[model samples]
Target: MTTLLQIDSSITGPNSVSRTLTTAIVEKLREANPGLRVIHHDLAAAAPAHVTPANFPSAHPISAAAGDAPEFAAGRAASDAILDEFLGADIVVIGAPMYNFSIPSQLKAWIDRILVPGKTFSYGAEGLKGLAAGKRVIIAVTRGNFYGPGQPTASFEHVETYLRSVFAFVGIPNPEVIIAEGVQLGPDARQTALDKALQQTAGLNAA
Candidate 1:
């Protein structure tokens, strides 16, 4: 059976457009694949600790000073679990909302745990190579204002661009992205954008 990892980073609860899209996308996937195993991680409810000197890569080694701290040891264990989840999943669905022109800090913290050096990517004499390939990634994005291609403030759109770059660096280059922009413009615009985004989710491939 295929395992799916569903991650929600929205702090807005029911009001988050990204969260709504992700739910619909997951539902569609479930309809297509019977007995699909899903592991849901809500970053807003239980945010991962930010990367710090105490729990950095060096801390994982017993000889490192930071490794002496009990807190650091526990942090390392948690990070390992997060990485394992990503590696075990065949499909990953992320709800990414734009917060001040970028993704939520909670989401960023979760990302820091998975982008491990030798686990997700590696460097060789030839060049940098991504190890975590073959997994399907789909991101649901929401922005208050329009920041799509050719938009006036497109340069400020960091959520989608950053996510794409991160996933590509980890070996999945062409992740499917569903976006709902201009959500805060007004009632009509918000509904219109949401409806369009929901429609896009219906077309996602189950395989």
Candidate 2:
């Protein structure tokens, strides 16, 4: 059976369009494949601690963080678990909502945990090598304002760009991105954008 890791990072709870679309996308995937093991991780509800200077020590490099230091060991373990989870998943679905022209700090912290040297990637003599390259990722994005090519806020939209760059660095460069824009405009605009995103979700290549 294929394993899917679904991460929801929206702090808006039930009103979050990204979460709504993400759930639908996972359901669609589940329908396409039988007995798919899905893991749901909510970053908003349980955000991981931010990476700090204390954990930057050579002995506390996440994977080897559990030697003897009790205080730093927990952070190291969390980081290791985060990286391991991503490495083990066949597919990843992320509900990423745009907050203040960027992603949530919680989600960013999660990203820090996974982008470990020699774990998810390595700097070889060839410049850089991506060790974890085969996993498929689907990102569900919700934007309060328009951020497409022609939109005024296009340049300010960091949600997609940051995710794309980060994932590419770790190996998966071309991920399938679905967006729900203009969500906070009004009722009609929100519904229209949401419905459009959901349509895209339904037609997604979950195979």
Top candidate on lDDT is 1
Runs of candidate 1 exceeding 4 Å displacement: 56-65
Q: What is the TM-score of each candidate against the true structure?
A: 0.94, 0.93
Task: Give all candidates' CA lDDT scores.
Answer: 0.89, 0.87
* TM-score result, candidate 2: 0.93
What does candidate 1's lDDT look like per residue over 1-207, in tens digits?
Answer: 899999999999998899999999999999989799999999999999887756554323332655457766767777778888999999999999999999999999989878877788988997889988999999999999999889889999999999999999999999999999999999999999999999999888877
lDDT of 2 by residue, 1-207 (tens): 799999999998998899999999999999889799999999999998888744532333543544556676666666768878898999999999999999999999888878878778888889888778999999998999899998877899999999999999989999999999999999999999999999999999979
Question: For model 1, which pairs clash?
Answer: none
